[model samples]
Target: MKKYIKIARPDHWIKNFFIMPGVAIAFLLTEHSLKDINIFKLICAFFATCMIASANYVINEWLDAPFDKFHPTKKNRPVVTENMKFSVVIAEYIALIAVGVILSLLVDKLFLITSLVLLFMGFLYNVKPFRTKDIPYFDVLSESVNNMLRLMMGWFVVTDSSLPPSSILIGYWMAGAFLMATKRFAEYRMIGNPEVAGLYRRSFKLYTEKTLLASALFYSLISTFCLGVFLIKYRIEYLLCMPLVFLLFSYYVAMSFDPDSAVQRPEKLFKEKKLMLLVFVIIIAFMILTSVDLNFLHRLTSNSLVWVRLD
Candidate 1:
């Protein structure tokens, strides 16, 4: 059981949190009553995504086992440590993919499309010919595309229409890209060998501290702008919460630059108590402020007549 859990790569499950933003943005934009929302369908979408993502991780680990054995940190993974058999991992992958596909099909056509796209992308990331991560820009592009698909999956599950060019979605995408770039930067700095970096990822050579810093700064600015726009568009009084977003981005960028502090594994930062506390505090504060003026903000902008009269 322990081996199976390790093989499942529970640490990667954190990525599933991507589902929340779409649901939150959809609710914020549409103002749909909670009772009317189909929570079950959303849950199904979340589960299906988790299964598919986990399967991808398993396959990736299996394929990279040889290289991982040389990685300073990744060498400790169950697959690398010989705690799990490749055959068992393969079986799990097949089962996960099967269940993920069936569950996704049960939802809607949009869900089916998103699931298939994710599966194909995962295969392309790991397999040859279309091994996107081995290419130059395609590496970052593939990661960003997957992130966008995950965000869209949630939006499709909730609302049948295509997601609008909302500030929240844009902000989320920028943040995701920023994180991806930082991950590559950190890996390059930690390994100190371009060949090893390239072994793990194809875009490692393209990243440098200066380039990464610039990219991070650009994304941070765009994210902040998008969040501000979201608040204004929705007439949300919690625009003040925008500072928390800035702080979070700044903290991560600061850590990413410090060789000792910058964790090679991007997911490790989330597990750190101090970092998690800071994130928790910011989220709690934002929630409180947003909830406080919720009704008033809704009333001020919800009625079409109110906007016309103001004009």
Candidate 2:
């Protein structure tokens, strides 16, 4: 049972939390939005995404079983270690695919569409002739698209009224790009030897440390600027969170300098005290800013439905 659980890699599900940000963006605009949410359906949406992502992991592990033997950290993965039976992994993958698809079908049309796109993208990343995972920049770019799909899924899970603001989605995409780039950077640094890194991740063979860092910096700046636009267009007071955001991003960059930094596995943030506190503070500030109806913002932004989009 423990081996089975390990093979599922539930720890990676933390990435599925990306589904909530769009919901948060939409709810912050709606009156009595909390009451309007479908808690049960939202919960299902979360689990469905987790299952879909897990299924993808299964495919990856199965395909990489041979190559994983050469990877330093991945050498101990269940597939490589043979701690879990391949038959069991295949069974779980089938079950996950069924459950994930069925759950998505139970959601609304938009939610279903987003879920399918997420699944399709996941397949492209790991499997087939065009496996983006082995392609240098394309690997990260394809992986980042999952963020937009997750965000859209969340947006539809709560309400089918309309889309979240463009600025919000763009910011989220760039932010994901920033994180992906950082992961590549950490991989390059931690692996130390270029040849070793290539064995673990083929794309690393095409990336220099300088190129990866430059990509990370470029992505973070674009994400920050888009986020700034989002806040300004929605609530000017939200701009106060900028300092915290800057600090958090800086801390993340500093952490990436360490070969074994938790940044590589963002899910490990739960175990990071200082970073978690900073994130907590940021969340609290945003909650307070959005919980109330700020009249001026509605008046300031055009498209009337722009800020809260009450229409």
Candidate 3:
């Protein structure tokens, strides 16, 4: 019974918190005031995202068991280590999806559709015939799409009638891609053998450490550029948070180089006190930026020339 639960990988649900930024951003942009926001619906949206994510995890674990056997630590996952009933695993997957659908229905139509797309992406990623996870860079891009989907889910929960700014969505997608690429880079480094890593993940067949690092850099650049557009277009105050955001990404990249890096186990990342502290600071900064009117910051975006004299 516990093995069934473990296969669902509830710990990975922390990734669903990606939805929070969407919700917050949507609330800030929408006509709805704070009093108009529905806390119950927000909770429902979050849990719905969790359930669908768990459903995906269940299928992923079951399908990847064979490949995971080649992985050092993943070889011990419940699916790989224990005798699992195929029927039970399928049932669990369906049950989780059902729960997610029910909860999503309570949130909004757009949320429900986005939740279904997230589930479908899991199939596209883990299932045969069309498993994009086997296709090198596509693996990262496909998996990273979940980040944008979660953001959309959060946005719809608050205001299904409107869409988030495309700049922010693009920025969020590239940020997720950057994170996924870094995870791949860390995993490749930890494996330390291309052949072994390739056996564990088909995409690794063509992914050298250098290639992954290069891709990560590319994604980060795109992310920052689009996010910059978002900050400038929506609220110049957010530009203040950009430096800390860059610092956060830089710190994450540095940590990926550590021996047996924590980047490999994102769920365990909370144990990194410094990283968590930085995240907390960034969150506080965002909250402050969102709440206050920093109209003066717009002057920085103006084309006005400043008078200067060289001494």
Candidate 4:
């Protein structure tokens, strides 16, 4: 029983916080006040997301047990260490899916559809014949798409009438990609042996530390560019947060260089007090920017074609 629960990885559900950004963005874009929100529906949306994510984790653990043995830390996971019954694992996965589906029904139609897509993505990532996780860069992009899907789930919970801005969605996806690439880089570094890492993850055979870092750089650059467009188009006030954003990314990159990086275990990242503090500060800043309108920022960024008198 304990093993079954452990395989669900409730602790890792912190990743579902990604959904909050969608909620926030929805509120911001829709100009909704607190009174307008359906709190019960929001709670249902959150739990539905958590349940589906757990289902994904269950399947991920079961399927990756073979490869996880090659991982130093992951070798200790319940699936790899315990003699678990296949039937029980399948039951757990189905149960979680059922719970998620039921909860999603309480939310809007778009949320329900997004949750289903999130579940399907887990199959595409972990199941054979379509396991994009085996493909080098595709692995990163495919996994990161969950970030966008989760965001959409949050957005739809608030309003199903319209989609999120493409610029912000693209930025969020690229940001997730950057984070995923960094995680891979940290894991590759910790493994310290290319052959061993390759055995653990098929994508590693084609990934070098330099290449991974380069990919991370590319992802960050693209994220920044898209996010900049979003801010310029929607809320120029967020431009004030850009410096902190750069600092956050640079700080994360530095953390990946550590011998034991928390990037590999984001669920345990509270151990890095300074990093968590920075994240908190960034969140506060974002919240403030979301509410306040800086009209002067628009004035500053506005294009004013000055007329020069020509002889």
Span of ten consecutive residues with least summed lDDT in model 2: 298-307
> Per-prediction TM-score, please?
0.81, 0.89, 0.95, 0.95
Per-residue CA lDDT of model 3 for 26-141, tens digit only, reads: 87788876687798999999999999999999999999999999998999999999999999999999999999999999999989999999999999999989999999999999
Ranking according to TM-score, highest score first: 4, 3, 2, 1
Candidate 1 per-residue lDDT, tens place, 157-254, comes to 77766564567767777777777777766766788887777665655666665776677677768768887887777656767677776787777876
lDDT of 2 at 77: 81
Error of 4 at 222 (Å): 1.0
Alpha-carbon lDDT, every model: 0.74, 0.83, 0.92, 0.92
Segments of candidate 2 deviating more than 4 angstroms: 83-88, 291-311
For candidate 4, write residues 1-311 as lDDT tens digits: 99999999999888888998898889888967668889899899889999999999999999999999999999999999999999999999999999999999999888999999999999999999999999999999999999999999989878888999999899999999999999999999999999999999999999999999999999999999999898877888888998988998999999999987899988887779988899899889988988898888776655332222331
> What lDDT is reached at residue 134 by model 2?
95
Report the number of backbone clashes for model 2: 1
- lDDT score for residue 188 of model 1: 69
- Candidate 4 stretches with Cα past 4 Å from truth are 291-295, 304-311
Q: What RMSD does each model have against the real structure? A: 4.5, 4.8, 3.1, 2.2
